[model samples]
Target: MQDRDDAITPGWVADLAEIGELVSGAYGHYVERMEMLPGPMRTDYAVPLAAGQIEVLRADGRIAGLLVLVPEPEHMLLDNVAVAPWAQGRGFGRRLMDHAEARARAAGYDRITLYTHVTMVENIEIYLRRGYVETHRAEVNGLHRVYMAKRLG
Candidate 1:
């Protein structure tokens, strides 16, 4: 796993498409439940990639997962985390999440924040297992979002 904090470069550009595909594949199943494309599916990876807020997790030298983490003044925002559909059962999501917390710790942050669609129960459950507490819920951009936070010791 590597976290890229430099301005967008050729390598980052090349990873954009793959990141999009990974996010789409991971969240596409919720289209029926949500009656529209999920937020992650509609995201343009370039914005975060250019801002150096994206990180990629590779398995066997191929992109298996990606994380979008933004450092806030008080907390690290784990904006997104997606595991390739094919890699779902292999613990890549957990690894990426572990990486997120590690990054936050390395950056001197004591907390990490994230949100997921309300309908994404599996994701909420996973976050709960990782010691994240529900902060609140709100409708943002037409999506019901469940916000969560983890205090990093």
Candidate 2:
């Protein structure tokens, strides 16, 4: 990771886009089955990072993962966690969750929340193992959403 806390740069966005594409499979099946908006593949990630809320996770001295977060009135929203497809299964996701929890605590939030498609069963298990409890499940705009939250100290 870079040693700076500034907003994401254009170069950073490009790097994230590449990783987003490579890691799009995490949501590919759900997106296809539900015809979800944006279709699981992304080229534009600037909207989420526009407020300088995105962070990068590095691997092999290169940009390989992203953690997109947004601070709300009561908690921090873990908007996205993407690890390069090439870099998955190497414990990067767990590390990213740890990073998110640490950052949320530093921001004075006791709770952090995130959501994933219902069909992303593996993701749900991972979150549960990370101490996130299932808050609810809903279908919106033809997409099934499974929401989860973790309370931090």
The model with the greatest lDDT is 1
RMSD of each: 4.0, 4.0
Candidate 2 lDDT, tens digit per residue, 100-151?
A: 8988999999999998777778888999998999999987655678999999
Q: For candidate 1, write residues 1-153 as lDDT tens digits.
A: 344432122227778888888888889999999998898888888998899998887765567788899999999999998888887788778888888999999999999999999999999999999999999999988999999999999
lDDT of 2 at 95: 78
Cand. 1 TM to true fold: 0.91
TM per candidate? 0.91, 0.80
Cα displacement (Å) at residue 5, model 1: 20
Least lDDT summed over 10 consecutive residues: which range in candidate 1?
2-11
Give the Cα RMSD of candidate 2.
4.0
User: Residue 25 deviation, candidate 2, in Å?
Assistant: 4.7
Q: Pick by TM-score: which candidate is best?
A: 1
User: Against the unseen true structure, what C-alpha lDDT does each candidate score?
Assistant: 0.85, 0.72
